[model samples]
Target: MNKRFYIIFTVILVIYFILKYLSGFYIDFEWFRQNNGLSVFWVLFMTKFNVQAMFGTIFIVLFLLNFLMIRILGGKGRFFAENFLDRINIPAIGSSRKLLLLIVTAVVIFTGFVMGGGASAFWKEYLMFKNSVPFTGFPADPVFGRDPGFYVFSLPFYKFLYGWFMSTLVIITIFTVLLHVLNGAIQKTVRGVDLSPFSRAHISIMLAMMVILYGLSYQLAAYELLFSQIGKFYGAGYTAVNANLLAYRAAEVISFIAGALLIFNVFKRSFKLPVIVMLTLIPVYFILGVIYPALQQRFIVVPNELGKETPYIQNNINFTRLAYGIDRVEEIPFANKRELTYADILKNRETLESVRLWDWRPLKQTYKQLQELKQYYYFNDVDVDRYVINGKKIAVNLSARELTIENLGVNSQTWQNQHLIYTHGYGLVMSRVDRITSEGLPVLIIKDIPPV
Candidate 1:
């Protein structure tokens, strides 16, 4: 078993590396680039170089190493068939199943709350957005309200719930398996404490539950992903819109029902109903969630483009304008006089003086050398804005886009820096464009002073 495991692991690693390299080549291909337009391939390529992927890779490797170490320690010659093979009924940790369920439920909810930034942040942001909006009606947003506070709040909760369910299921299943494996190995090594082996029924049920939960999680994730793309579906015409909506909504409903059934089966300690549901529902899901949508797009949407696309186009226009606050901007026709007077040039002297002659690259470097007080807070860009200073409107060059501690690379970002120390940005460095001090530095109008 050890040898087989080693061989399989090595083969999988080799295949993974080969595919990883091949993916690089595939992404660089012109046809692939044109067809995909920076899709999952791009995301994978970028993620490979990130800290999260590094940590994830390290974790998997560690788990594999642990398995190898355990196998090596428990030599084949020391194996006792009677002790290892005999099925033992291990009772629940708690007094009753209900107690176990309650503990699990609490843990899952706590995990969700922590991972989702707690209820305080959610409600605070929701209320802040609701109060900030000037007006509320259909023009502001068609579905939810003027602001997307409800949608935004609900999105994180949805993610949290899904993550909690999947993670809890995975942890429990892995713990059960690991407990059995470790118990066997311990029994072989130490002779003092007698430990019960996992019963066949318990093992089978745990494995089945894990598999069912995994499948349900994956299907639900697909539903979530599809549903989230509703905003991007606006311009795709009525048929395409209808098809995608139907597909995602149907997937979500079915996935929810299937998930509920699985939970029911878990409590009942029988996989019959859940198995039947999975077998029946998956094919129907494939048809409605995949095939029907494709057929609708290919036949109905693509053919009647001019006729069917008008309403969708209007929706896209209206929603986009509302979302972006573009409808509020007044548009006036401009008739260029085609004449510039001396008075006009004098009137716009501040703007003309602000026309930057110095290259931003050198200016940024100089600003960093002279102005940047902290190492973490560095200037990213140099901007020019007109400010009223000392009863005179003057164009001032500034470096306001500071890279705060939170803006540092992912490896450097900590919870403390992200949430506490770096809640807001450092103040800007503003200097008059025309004025220069004796030391050849631009005269500082506004230095490291944050907004009042």
Candidate 2:
């Protein structure tokens, strides 16, 4: 019987591990390499909501409860062990079921390591991404803060076992192993206690009930809601992964509570006071920890492009800050869609140009704004800076070198200075550059401008 259980556990673990490595596990690392930082929430969700989430959650909780129950009852003078077994006159587990469970769990975990593609392309990519410098999209800091008491709740045990990623796979794998041990112990305890068929049935039904509740709490309900929320908001890409880390922390709390509750339910006869207190206090603590962050105000970056000198809001908007009045979200424009093209190409490149070199900027300029004037204004021949239409060769005087409607008018696109832009069609070549050649503005028609 023990050997059969071991085989079943091993098969399940191996299948899951292989799935983990194949499902783009290393993309997280690739993201960190390109983006310059890791978002733990993102990776957790992707791994958790997989098919394994369903089976793994339920099995682990019941398995652990079985172990603790055996340990408490197996001891001399334990209430349930003394009361129930005394009345039934049945043999409790003569041998340790916990040990059998441990063996099965070990086999399953070993399979996970072996079948999960022993460090292939995914591993390599993850390593590269982690080693590279992190990328920051915004010009400011963007990592979310963690709760201080998180480590307090997750202290010496769970942390020591998993070593940090705190993923569902690791959680499931760990709890599953523990469950096997407890399940074996409980079976042994029943045999030693000498319970009847009816009692056995009663126990089995109760165990099943606990399993279902724990499953819903640990795997299905808590973590799924959080991860699903993240996926819906963040989009299914590496850039939007930070949301998953928050969900993982929430899931961890659920696991801890479910484990506690299972033990309390099994040993309802003795230690009832302590169990009740733990049940009440622990849940309240976890609930507060989860809610505090959501209540506090957070900084969010909102980006858009519109007409303005600088569109970035330069203040923090928090709960207290809101009382004084402030925009909830700040907007910053990354780029402008405005286009800049040359004005005139007709009477040499120097003769054709726009009224201003760069007019896309909101700054307005007039002819009087020129501090210095020059008859012959030269531009960066290699890099076209500015152009002159009627100015002659002379030194710049002053007045910031401005211009007016009298000195310059819109040039004709089809002027004589325009190049013959040819188009070969039906044995005819059309001049495509004529409009743009003389006057820089392609939109201007030859008839619109007065003849020079």
Candidate 3:
């Protein structure tokens, strides 16, 4: 009951925080103004019904994102490590002590990576716990990627066994609690020597391994798997710090500290030099992995789908819908209704070229106008004769024309002037003039053009 209450309370608090931060409400008046403006509070509060509404929206968005990523990636989350030892899968009944240790290691690393690293990381997470608009984005890369805190937390191993169940804090907390119970059970049932004995020399060696492995994983695994696979090859890569490297170093440092504690717990055989080094490094690592990565992953560069990277949404062509242009309008004689005219077509081609075009002319005028206006746009027509942005043909009729918009006749109830910059553009931006607030919700704006 106590744990359940804690869980429920935590969830509510998280939702509240996201609303407070992202929605821009505040107890501190100065912070709110610095972030946006004092007017943001009354405006957002009136717009959204408490923080729960904001959370509901975010949950839906994240779910859609996860679903889309799974479809495109062609695989479920990683289930186990790739080494030969992992192939020997015994069902839940026959799991051994070694397997348990391995699993623990994997869970710790996964948690660390997701959390982030260093004192600041933990502090951010703490603040996130207290306040909630997550200062970060989702951490899991569709491509193979891990964070620094994950590395620090999952010390002494690079095994990928826990899968996606342990990816989030809620899940990780459950796993941690379960592990505590399981560890107690193992200690009682199995009476033997501690297999992992640490010495001054052993500690030195592990440190070396951490450095080597971190370097290799950064240079090879993370760069090759995560960054290169998506960024360079698919033209979706961003130049940034390597995630794998950060994870690896953080994990190694954590393990070193944990190992030191283990040395103290055992009946001391020999004590020569600086044993305290382990304590400093381990806790620092734990702080780094558990607190930092979680905090860091939340540090998002914005999702491409949000129309930051590309302002258009493209989908596979539907063959049945393609009949609009090819089949001419059928005229009705008795009712005196016009036949299925090509000009009245509702598909991508006519939608872009005829109805949606602000100027209703060829691509030349539209392109030239946008260039002069210095406004960015997107098109829904995939086969625009000789124009391209980011190598994909424009799929909608869109323009970046300047419009001196005012709030007097817009959605906002205030009479104010503002430049309506869109976040989701396309034809939607052009047609739904009313829906485009002076602050612009980004018109999913697509444009269509005549067949090239």
Candidate 4:
């Protein structure tokens, strides 16, 4: 029985690893395949792998090293050796907690590696920020003095880096404090928990990084005001530009000062200073980050919304047009003449003949009913477009025929039938939009299952 179990487990592990390897290659070829070649795919795959490995190593190494430093070096007494196993009459992990250590280390490694994989998705952002080029011949945004591409190509990676470091530090800080408690570095005194100077210094330095990132968060949020949905329109409005932007700058400065103070406390090795600094951040965030902006929006911007938001509205419009590459569009004036002569009729007859009268909603249903030759062939939509056919520019309604195998009966909808035999639907149904039959049906320009 043991031998059979081992054989089954071994086979499962082999198959699992094989599937993992094959899936990586499949996804690499399918999702990537940039330039339809192997090099780009390999580059992307390795980039992701390298990033994941590097960050994963950082997370695990930092965790393990810190754990060793505090638990092994700084720890005292049998507290560090304590495990939960003995409480329930289970065999206790040895005084060294070797089993507990192994379990904790495994959990931390798994979490870090999984987090690294998720973070790897931001590689494009990193690459873009690294290789960010200035836009040519394009005007900068009126407020930021940055090209439109800065928001698109740069900001995301900065935000991600900030978040990653902040999260890592916070996690490490919590783990360190917990470990400190488990050891005797932080002992429960008569008054409260008494943190040793050594633990205080370590935690303060960790918090200094967090405070700095916290400050930087406001700065990032400043740029993100352009994408804010709190207002009537997207982008910075009166309160945001007038109050919120200024407030973010102030918060950033305050955060930097606060972070520096925390570092100063690390050297002082006094828990009091770091506590005071962190306690202040709550009110600072609420007042400057939240309340100030809300007050400005409610009191000032609300009274004269049109007057306040006009400039911002214009900015949104200009940026939107710029984003879509329609900023240089030319407008022509047209004369609204009511009467027409016979010469006018003859001159514009070709254009008049191409005016569409059929709406696509009913036309799609009509195509599905009449031209859809098979039940599996689905006409998704009727696309109205122009094409020059035989030297005449004509308007036509076209519907691409696609497969819907789910419409097949249960017995007929087999995997082999779906994947191999009837894989895709071919051809499109097309007709001149203006030319309708006597019975009000479309005049077929191109028809049939094989596509005429």
Q: Pick the candidate with the highest TM-score.
A: 4
Between candidates 1 and 4, name the one with more favorable TM-score: 4
- Candidate 2 lDDT, 1-452, residue by residue in tens: 45666578779977887788657657756767578555653554343443233334333444445445444543432223233223332123223444444554564445333323222213333333334442222222122222322222322223222222233344443544344233332233644533322223324334334433433333322222322322113211111223233444554465455445544544453333334543664565455444432332122211211111021111122322443444355777889776555443344553332232323221112221221133222111111122232463311111111222222234533443233421111111111122333434322111111211
Choose 1 or 2, whichever is better by lDDT: 1
RMSD, every candidate, angstroms: 20.9, 19.0, 23.8, 8.9
Candidate 3 wrongly placed segments (more than 4 Å)? 1-257, 260-263, 266-279, 282-452
Count clashing residue pairs per candidate.
Answer: 0, 46, 63, 0
The lowest-lDDT stretch of 10 consecutive residues in candidate 4 is 82-91
Please write out the lDDT profile of model 1 over residues 183-252, one tens digit for every residue. 3632533655332322222333444554455445444444344234333363344554577655766666
Candidate 4's residue-wise lDDT over 8-102, tens digit each?
A: 87689769967996898797697666657788787777778877887888888888887887766564323323433333231343344555575
TM-score of 4: 0.66
TM-scores of the models, in the order given: 0.37, 0.26, 0.21, 0.66
The number of the candidate with the highest lDDT is 4
Worst 10 residues of 1 by lDDT: 193-202
Write the residue-wise lDDT of candidate 3 on 322-375 in tens digits: 324423457666876667766656544524432232323544353444332323
